[model samples]
Every structure is written in structure tokens, then in C-alpha cells.
Target: MAARYLVSPRGGRRAYPDITSALRAAEARGRAALIEIAPGHYEEALTVRGEIRLAAAEGPGSVLVSRPRGAVLDAFGAVSVHGLTLAGRDAAVDIVGCHTGTLTLDRTEIRAHDGVAVHGRPHTSVTLRDSVVLYGRTVFTGSAGLIERCRFTDAANNAIAAIEGARVTVRGSRIEGSRIHGLRVCDAQAEIVGCEVTGTGQAAVVADTRGELAVTECAISATHAEGILFIEQSRGSVDRTTVTDALHGIVTKSGAGPVVRGSVFADCRDTGINVQDAGLGTFENCRVTHARNVAVFSTKGGAPEVRDCLVSGGNVGIAVTEGGRGRFARIGVEDLAGTALRVYDEASAAFEDVRVERCPAGLEARGNGGTTAEVTGAVFRDISLGAVAIDGQSRVTLRNVTAERGVMGFAVSGEAMLQVTDSEVAGVSGGGFAALGSGRLVARNITVTGSEGLGAFGTGSAYVDITDGTFTDCAVAASFDEKAAGRLVDCVVNGTSGVAVRHNGLVDLVSLRTSLPVVRHKEKPAAPPQIVQVLNNPVFNGPVFNGPVHDVQLAWNNGHVVQQQTEGDGTHP
Candidate 1:
């Protein structure tokens, strides 16, 4: 029959004086043992080689097991401790070796001085339920374990660390005041659900694994460093979590792919979410607020896809740099301190249905060497510097965009290329379109009105081709320098204070209608403007062609007409 050993502080019938005596008596019989301890403190160091169940005869706080120096229990076979307080200097419980050895703790409290509270080695597993660990570490290497409803405080290292192919599941747990990470998994697998980790010196939850780690419905805050870090070829998912008051809310690097869904990151010292160094991430329906730096940052080939996200009150809302590529759709950035969207370096992005409001400069793309951006259905309003700024050999295409109440609209400089279609730029303090320094712009079906400067201004070898456009109430409808080039076809210019077209370079005006004069080629003494081609066009207030006409069959006056010529030298159609 299985032995039942009773232990008490005082001498009694069928009772041993100490717990170690009862445990030794059961081990000698070679049978399963149940050792019930009474309500007092028993100081002992025990190593069990057989199956044993050590339970308190009374409730918790009644049975205290204290070892002044070393570990309290080392079990090589099956061991269970229920409703007992274990106090020691070294590890309170160490489960080692094979043969399916298991250690189970139910309603137990483990207190240690400078060592781990529980250590599980290879082939050993530990299970904790409704337990508390104080002033110690918990490490499981090459082992598997489960922790439920546990609280850990004042850990010297990580409160709970699983490494070297260990698998651990922690549910409804809390860890506080850990010097390092509150929970760390390295080269292993971990699943943390309904956990809260606060006041950690390093990352609250850090997993640098070759396997997977999952965290669900967790709150991590008050970390000295990043709140959560999943890096080094790890794959994971964090869902419905909130992180606050950290240097970085979440950081993913080194080829890690972590999916974060339905999360909120607020009051971060640095970026709310940082993806770097070939890491790929996906964020959906998330919100970031009050970040000191960029809200969403992707750098160094980190390609992130963000959808249905909102960023408010941050520096740069979304920044992609250093060969990074981002695909953002249906995102809104409001009240930003710097540029709402910034793409630089060799990075490229595609944005769809994005809105930026109350920012300094919205949608800035700079190519130090190579950068590109394609934006569709973008709306920018109440900006300080300009709505869209593209420079430095970059190429940007904006389709179905609207810019209102900005300093300037569509500022393209430094050999850049900008193509905008079906867009409107109105109520801008500066020119509606400013293309400078060898830049190229191809715009179609654009409307510009209520600008403080020229509706379209080109200078310094810039090339502009605007077709099917409307310009109203501008300083000048279109102005081009001597080195610039432009072609306006089928456009209507009305209610401008200055001349409709002030051309000093090569200009072609075809099928243009205006209440003001259609074309005025400046006859500068140094560099004269060339009206290259005026085909099938009527002018209302134009000076007659007084200079030497290249094509004598076409004459220009207030009401001009073309005369037919012979086919030998001059011809008119």
C-alpha cells in the first residue's frame, strides 16, 4: 500500500518530528508517499528520488519550510508542493534529470536571497498555479512549463526566462521590479496571455528566438528601455496590447516578422513602433499618440505594411528611410510637429487614401541618391511649409490629390520628377505650383485658384507640361524663366491680376482660352522668349508679331489669323 507519513513539530503517535524524516521513511518503502506537515517552521534540505506529495495539513502560511543556506528541495522524480512557504538562499526548488520528472506548485510562495526561486533543467518540467515568487530568478532551459496566476517581484535577472528550446506558457501573471527583462525567451517558444509587466530596467518582454513567441491581451509599461523587443529571426504576434512610457514601444529588427494588431502605443520617448534592419512587420487598426519621435519608423530595408492606422501629435508620423519600403493605406496623420510623411534615401512607398492635417510640411520625399513615392487620393490641409515637397532626384506621382490652406503646393526641386493628375491646389499662401532647378512636372486636369503668387512658376531649366487645367485669381497664370520650358494645352486662364503667360523660355500654347491676353513672350534684350508653336489658338489682348516670324504664314495680332503658304519653304495647316 502507498505510505501516508504525518509530520509535526512536537512528538506524537505515528508522526515524525520533521518533514525530512517523514520523506525518508516513505522513500525507504519504495512506494508513492504523501507527507502532510503541521503548522510550524521546519528547516531542512531534501532530495527526493521517488514520487512524493508534500502538502500542508493546515492552510497556507501555516506550514513554513525554511533552509538557511542552500536549496530547499531538489527532486529527481515526481514532486508536488501544495500550500507551503519555501524560503532559502539558493534556489528554492531545482528539478533535474530525466525519467519524466515533474515539479508542481499549487498556492506556494517561494522566497530566495540571491539565486533563482525555481530552476528546471533538461527533461524536467515545472507547473506553477496561484503562486508568488519574491527576490529571485526563474530559469528553465530545455524544459517545458506552465505558470498561471503567479506574481514575481524584485528579480535579480529576468523574472521568468526560458531559453534553449524551452517552451513556456504564462497566463494571468504579473512581474514587477525586475532588473533585466520581466520575461525573456531566447531560442525558444513562449505564449504570454493576460499578463502585466511593469517597472523593468530593460525590455518588459523580450524574445530573441529562432522559434515563435506570442503575447495576447498584455499591458507593458514603465520600462527603462524598449517595452517589447522581438528580434533575431523570431516570428511572433502581439494582439490587443497597450504599451506606454518607454523609450520605444515596440522594436523589431534582424529579419524578424511580428504582427501587431489592435494595439495602442502612447507617451513613448522615442518611436512608437520601430522596424529596422530587414525586419518585416504588419500593423492593423492601431493608434499612436504623443510620441517624442516618429510614430512609425521603418529604416534599413525594413518593409512594413500599415493599414487603417492613426497617428496624432507626434514628430514625423510615418518615416521610411535607408532602402526601406512601406505600403500604407487608409491612414490618417493629424497634428504632427514635423513632416507628416517622409520618405528618403533609396526608399520607396505607395500610399492610398491618406489624409494629413495641421502639419508643418506634409508628404516630403527626398532622394539623396534614389527615392520614389506614389500617392493616390491624398488630402492635405492647414500645413505650414507646403503640402507636397519632392526634391533631390526623387520621383513622386500624386493622383486625385487635394491641397488646401498651405504655404505652397507641389514644390518640386533639384532634378526631381512630379506627375500629378486630377488634383486641386487652392487657397495657398505661395504659388500653387513651383518647379525649380531642372525639375520636371507633368500635370493634367489640375485646377489652381486663390494663390498669392503665380499659379504655375518654373525657373532654372525646369520643364512643365500642364494640359487640361484651369487657373483663376492668381498674380500671374503661368511664368517661366529663360532657361525653363513649358507647354500649356487646352487650358483656361481667367481673373489673374498679371499677364496670363509670361514666357521667357520656349513655350507652346495650343487651344488656350483666356479673358486676359493668351501669350506674352518677353522681348528681353539679352534673352528673348520663343513662342515655339501656337496652333489653332485665338488671342484676345496680344501684341502683333513684331519680331522676325519663323513661320510667316501665321500672324499674331489682337485677333490673329493664319494665311496659307506654298509647300516649298513655308507651310500652314
Candidate 2:
């Protein structure tokens, strides 16, 4: 029953006036053909080889197949184009050579004034269901396609392009207003499901070079650039995608590697997941909101692997600069205006179970001296400033960390190097672990509670070494000013309302136990011996222990007056 042919410009006698004489009287009645086209304009420029079924008896813009120049349906093999309205200048549905059947364009209405508006080659097999491709660009070189529910509008270029070894599958498509890139895959292999790319001038899904993309549940919006763009050595996988108001949301650079899962980058103006240069990615369960800048930006030598993420209101949430390196697990950065995880130049990062809340600053490792940050089980809450801020010549390490209600909690300055173990600094207003300038702090079993100020601070030529420490209710529980140097072993300064150990400089107290009033020697006469070297058994009594002692030690077990002096000629013992 494949042999009906009736095309009319009213040339009667069983009607076959145009449509290339009704496809040459159905190819001399030698195979499959059904060319029923009756109503209106047909400027003729068709070359269908063999099995054809070109319908449009009166539906769909009432048949208008205009040519004016090259390609107006030049399909080979089994072609089926229903409800026609194909107009062209060059390529308005041109499925070239060596076609292995199938070139169906159901409910068609493709119109190109310049170039491509559906041009498939390389053993072509294209099927665009519920079609409506307008104004140029819809190329598929090594074709093998299926674009269902299609409607690519106002595209002068790239509103669907699958290069070289193309094998495309775009389902539920609706790409609108694309001047450039609303779906482009270079060394082709694409699978975009439930797509809805809107208002794109550039990059609303582009996988360059060795392209291979799979964007599922897609809904990319208003992209001027980058809403899923994997450059050069592209690799893919972006599931559950939803990128809104994008400038940059999902951009994996040069040596691209993508594995973005459960994505949702909202209100992005810049960087919501940009892994640069030697890019490599693995972002799982992502959700970056209000990204005005850096919600997840790994620069130059980017190495990303962010897991279980949720970054909110960004100015900077996850920024691994220049020589970037990342491995952030279980992240949750909230309400950031700035600095909530930024590892500067010569970068290196590794954070686990991270949580930074109400940020003004939390986790800022500065550059130059090769920055490095390693945090485990991190939690910095309501940080208004300094909740782990290590400066240049950086090297930071915190294990099982928690800095709560911070104004300052772990702020190590230049020539930096900090190592905090089993950390905890609660209710800080200022100084709950601060080592300035020539910074170097190594803490273990740390716990500084309710600090209104000073619960472990070292000034200028800073150097603090705290072991088995705990300073509770601190206003001043541990401070070493100006040419600073410190070492508090097995320390415990409990409920200090003021001065528990505030030496103007140099301090080394082992097994020092205090409940307020330990030492406060701010009188640095020509500075250099504001020393407080108290050995082993220390349970110092009030009177603000005016310092200047070399090796003082006191002992008195049970009743606990255990203070012992070894060699103290200059004062206070």
C-alpha cells in the first residue's frame, strides 16, 4: 500500500503538476512512496532518493517548500516529512550521502535564510519530532540523532550542533534565542534529557574538543556564557541540572573532566563550579545559591572533588586560587559575604565534613610560601571574622575542629604555620588562639572556652606550642606579647576573669594549672626578660605573679600549693 502520489498546481489528470512530477510518478512505481502535497507554493528544490513519504495535504502552514538557493530537503533513503513548511537558502533539512534510512521530521517547519537549519551527514539517521527549527544552525556531522519535542527558535548559530562522531539524543527540547551555543558538542556524543536552554549568547551547554556530554533533567537559563561548558579535552556527566541566570555555572577548563551530580547553581553571575586550566571534576549533590562570585572556583591547576555540597549567598565560598587543588567533603557554607574557604596561590586544599555558618570570614589560607590547608571534621559557626585565617608562607592543619561564635578563633599571621589538633574555641569575641607575624602555632587537645579576649595569643615574633590545653572563661588566660615565644604543656587555666598567664614575652610553663592570677608582666624594661619559666608542679596563687623568673617550680601535693623555683634571682618567686 506504499504507492500513492498526488501533487497539484491543478494540472489535472490524476494530478501530478509539481513536486518533481510527483517524484517522477513514484519512481516508476518501483517501491515505497506517498507524496501527497496539495496546497500552495512549492518553489521546488528536493532530491529524496527512494523511500519517501512527504505529506502536507493542507495542514501545517498549508505546505510551502521554497528554495531560492541550495538544499530544501535533499534527503537520501527513507525520508518522512509531514506537515511541511521547509524554506531555505542553503540547508533546510539536508541529510547528505550514504544514508542508512531514517530521516524523519514530523510536524516539520524548518526555515533557514543563510546556512544550516538541520544538516546531517555521516551515514545520517535524523529524527526531529514535533519539530520547529528556525533561522539557521542545527548541524550534525557524523549524525545519529533524535531530538524529541523540538523547538529551537531564533538561532543564527549553535542551537544544536554535534560535530565529528555525532551520536545525539536531545529529549523534550526547547532551546530559545541562541545567537551562539545553546547546545554544542565537538568531538561529539551528547545526551541531554528534558532540556530547556534559554536566552543563550554563548554556552548553555558546550562540550568542546573530545566532547562527551550527558546533561539530565536540564533547565539552563539566561546564559551569556558558561552554564555547562567543558573546554578542550572534554568529558561529561551533569545530572539533575538546573543552572539559573548564569555567567558561569559548571565550567571545566582545558583538560576537562566532569562528573557533576544533582546540580543546582542559582543566580550565578560568576563561578558556581569552575574548575580551571588542567581541570578535573567530581562535584556531588551540589547546590550553590546566589553566587555573585566564587561559590566553587578552582583556578589554574584545578583539581576538584567536592562532595555533598551546599554553598549559599556567595562572595567567596570555595576558592582555591592559582595552583588550585581541592577535595572538600560534606560541605555546607552559609550566608557568606566573603571568605568561607579560600586557599590562595600555590594552593592546596583538603577539608572534610566542613560547615561554615553566617560567614564574614572562615578558612582563609594566604599565599606565596606555598599555601596548604587540611581541615578534618570542620565546623566554624556564626563567624564574623577570623575562624581559621592563616596568612602568607601558609601551612594550616586542624583536626576535629570547631570554632564557635567567632570574632577571632585561630588567626595565624605571616610566615604562617599552624597545627591544631582536636580543636575547640567557643563563644569567641577576640583571641581564642592568635599568633601574629612570624606565626607558628602547634596545639594539641585544645579547648578555649567563652573568650571575651585572650585565651591563647602570641604577638610579633610569634611562636606558641600548646599541649593538652584547656582555658575556660577567659578574658586573659594565656598571652605572650611582643617578641613572643610560648609553650604551655599539660595546661589548664580555669575560669579566668583576668590575668591567668600574661607574660610580655617568652613563656614556658609545663604542667601549669591556674584558676586566675598566674602571671602578668607587661613591664618590659628595654624588653628581653619578661620570662616566666615555671616547671613541672605549678599551682600558682594570686597577687598577679609579676613575672621575671628563669626556672621556678613549687611543690606541695594534696593541699595543692605545688610551686617550685629552680633558679630565680631577678624577682617574683
Candidate 3:
């Protein structure tokens, strides 16, 4: 067995001259040894071949180890170093190759000029506690490492990088001012907790390549790229974190699945949360704000779910496109310059209990073929162009929705289908509800009031079916073009305007009542060949029949009605 030795500049009978000589004598003994260095400066590189304990006699500042040529300490076997400061022109420490036991560093400080501070090789297990690495990066390849209570600063590249089967854990660490990612894990696994990472040129934390990374209780900000990036089939969990001032706060890319909870992402230059390329993201109790683009974006075949989230101050609050699918619940969006929620191009989504206010377009869905959306208990107020717009062969259903102060409250066009029930559209500058260009609408229990234009307008071969609704205070309550068709069943149209219902198209009126005169027949250049009838109904505020008079029972109808037009050129019945 080798005997422990102490090294000091003041030579004594039992003390060695330097750490190099002590290490030599210890290795020759063929056993474990402890070399205690006294307070002094040593300018030499020491490489260990066996188990050894090298420590400062007092504390970290008591002894200084500097090697101008190479690494200060290169350990091939089990080694423990404590309470020392190592400054190297090259690497400060390297733990390499087939460690039969554990390697540990405690209360140490390392300063590297050109090379990395700490490098771990394959088949090594290393641990660092209460350490500081300055001006260099740390790389762990195929090694299992643990880092705790450490501070890393001013790295030219990634502060900590784990690659190729490395398993690393970092806790209670502060990493700052890195040129690239603060912590990067590729083809490896990592767990980071209670860490603060800031001022990175790239993503603050990157997890890629089938790796599992868990980050909790962390603060990441001021990153040029995403604050947290999960890509290339990586799986991760991020919780209780605050990320701000990044291009994107959190991004899931290319088949990644990440669950984020209890987080706040604010003031991002781009989207606050972005999921793309078939990535699946789940966010709960998250708040995102002040994004320049879409606040939460799921596109390029991604699917995301957001619950209890608040998104505000963006061009679009949430956008799902390019075959994306999402579900949002209890979402509140306000003050958007563009559409609050947009689903387009074969995308589909469901929104419940959503509230949108002060947006140019509240909810818009446009698609070429296979887009669909369902919204329940949604309220939109103070919009510009329109509150809800559905177009391009898409379909949307809105229930218990309320819209106020918009141009066209609900606009449907281009063969789209919209069903609105238990909804209200009020204070609209244009038509309260419009169906244009082969669009279809099926509405029940809907109310429209205070529209400057017609309350309901259907044109260009559009179809509208009102099951039970009311329209008031508009130029014309219901107006349909010649090519359009609709039916009003158990509905009421009342307005201060002289005309309540005007239709050049075919409108089936069943139990329909109006407070203003109904224009049964429009005055065309010539009376149409078809015979029109004027009903003698008392529910109308004005005359029910205006065109012509026919047989008494034929003039009015529920079961039987007469068809006659006083203007000539049409046959009377």
C-alpha cells in the first residue's frame, strides 16, 4: 500500500518537493494515495494512472495549479479533486476511458484559455459540485455525469454539451453568455432543474435525437433562437419555467413530443409556442403574450393542445394550418391585429369557452378541401372586418357565440358551411350575417340587431335556413338575391325600415312574422312569368300582400293560397 504524502515549497523531511514527484512516488507504491498540496503556485501538468485524491490543504484559493502546456489533470482511473483552482492554457481537466470507479470534483474553480474546462470520455462517470467553469465549454461523450451548484460563464460555444449516449444531470446551476446553446443534449438524456440560463446566441436548451430531457423550475431568456427546443424525435417535459425575449419561446420540431405546464412565455420576437413537422405538444396553465407573429402556432402537420391559456398582443393569437390539429379550452385572446384564431388548409380544431376582443378578424377558417372547426361558448367583441369568416369549402359550427361591433358579423363564402345556434350578432356596420358564393348557413335561435346594412343577406346562389331567429333595426331584415334560396321557419323579422323581408329568390316562409312591410314581389323590368301571391296575415305590421289580389282563400296561405300579380304579363290563379 502507498502512503499519503504532503507537498509544500518549504521542504521538510517528510514532505515532497512538488505534486509531480509525490504522484510519481505514490504510483510506484502500487496502491491508492492522497496528495495534499499546501498553499502555493504550481506550474506543472499531473496525469494520474490510478486511484488518487489530490486536494488543496486549505481551500480553493490556498493553492493554484497552472499548466501552460496541456491539461492540468488528466485522470485515467478513479480520482477525486477538492478545494483547488486550476488554470490551463489547454483543458483544465480530462476524465478519459474506462473508469473502474467514480470521478468527483468538489468546490473547484477552473479557468481555461483555449480548450474546454472539463472533458469526459466514454465509459466514465463524473460528478461536479459547487464548481465554477469560466471561459470554456464542457463536453461529455458517452459518460454519465452530474453537475450541481455550478456556475458556467462566457463560453465561446455551448456551455455544457452531452452527446452520443451521455446521461447528464444538472441542478441549481447558472449558465450565461454562451455563443451557442447554453446546454445541448444530442443522442443523450439530460435532466436540468433549478437552473437559470440567459444570453445565449442560440437556443438556451436543446434536446434532440430520441433523447429524453426534463427541465423544471428554470428561467431562460434573451436567446436568439427558441428558449427551449425539442427536435428530431426528442421527448421532453418543461414545467414551472419562465421564458422570455426569444425568437420562439418553446419549439417542438420534427416528431418531437413535449409537455409544458405552468409556464409563462412573454415578449418573444416570433411565436411564443411553435409546433411543426408532426410534433405533438401539450400545454397547461400557460400564458403567452406580446409575440410579433402568431402567439401559439401549430402547422405543418403538427397537433397541439392548449388548456387554460391566455394569449394576447400578437398578429394572430393562435393559428393552425397545413393540416394541423388542435384543441384549445378556456382561452382568452385580445388586442390582435389579425385574426384571433385561424384554421386553414385542411386543418381542424375545437375551441371551448374562448373569448376574443378587439381584433380585426375574430375567428377565420379557410381551406381548399378538408378544414373544419367547432367552437362552443365563444364570445367575440369589437372586431373590424368580420367576427367569424368561413370560406373555401370549409365547415364551422359555432354555438352559444356572441359577436358585437363588427363589419360583417358572420361571413360565409366559397361553398363553405356554417351553423350558428344560440348566438347573437349586434352593432354590425355591414350585414349581420351574410352567405355568399354558394355558401350555406343553418342557424337556430339567432338574433341580429343594430346592423347598418341588411340583417341577413344571402346572394350568389347561397342558401340560408333560419329555424328560429329574430332580426331587428336594419335596412332590410332578410334579403335574398335571385339565385340564392332559403327558408325562414318560426322566425320574426322586425325593423324601423319600411321593408322587413325582400326576396328575389325563393323563400319558404312557415309561421314567419314581420313588423314591416314584406316585399313579396320585386319590380323587375317585366313581370316574371310565375304568378306571385300576397298573403293576408295579421302578424305583419304593414300589408302582407302588395303585388296583386286573387281568390280570398288563395290570397292567404297555410295550406292553401292564391297566386296573382296586378302588374300584367303573369297569369293569375
Q: Determine which window of 10 residues in candidate 3 has minimal summed lDDT.
A: 91-100
Off by over 4 Å in 3: 1-4, 10-13, 28-34, 49-51, 76-78, 89-100, 450-452, 472-475, 494-498, 520-522, 526-573
Residues 133-214, model 2: lDDT tens digits: 8867777789898889989887888888899998989999899888888889999998999889988898888898989999
TM-score of each: 0.86, 0.44, 0.85
RMSD of each predicted structure? 10.5, 15.5, 10.3
Tell me how far the alpha carbon of residue 377 in candidate 1 is from the true structure, in angstroms, after superposition.
2.1
Q: Is candidate 1 or candidate 2 better by lDDT?
A: 1
What is the C-alpha lDDT profile of model 3 across 244-276, one tens digit per residue?
899999999798888999998999999999998
Tell me the tens digit of each residue's lDDT in model 1 across 1-573: 557999998979999999888878988898898888999988887676678988989877788887777778787688888899988875434422122589888898888767778887877898989998888878878898899999999898899988999999999999999999998989988999999999999999988956578989999999999988888988889899999998899988888888999999998999998989987889999999989999999999998899999999979899999998899999999998899999999998899999999999999999865699999999998998899989999999999999999888898999899999999899987878878999999999999988878788889999999999899988788888868888999998988366688887487888888877655564543322244434435664433555766423333432554333344346631
> Any runs in candidate 1 off by more than 4 Å, and if so which?
1-3, 91-100, 495-499, 518-573
**C-alpha lDDT of all candidate models, in order:** 0.85, 0.85, 0.86
Model 2 residue 554 distance off true place after TM-score fit, in angstroms: 22
Better of 2 and 3 by TM-score: 3
Residue 529 displacement in candidate 2 (angstroms): 26
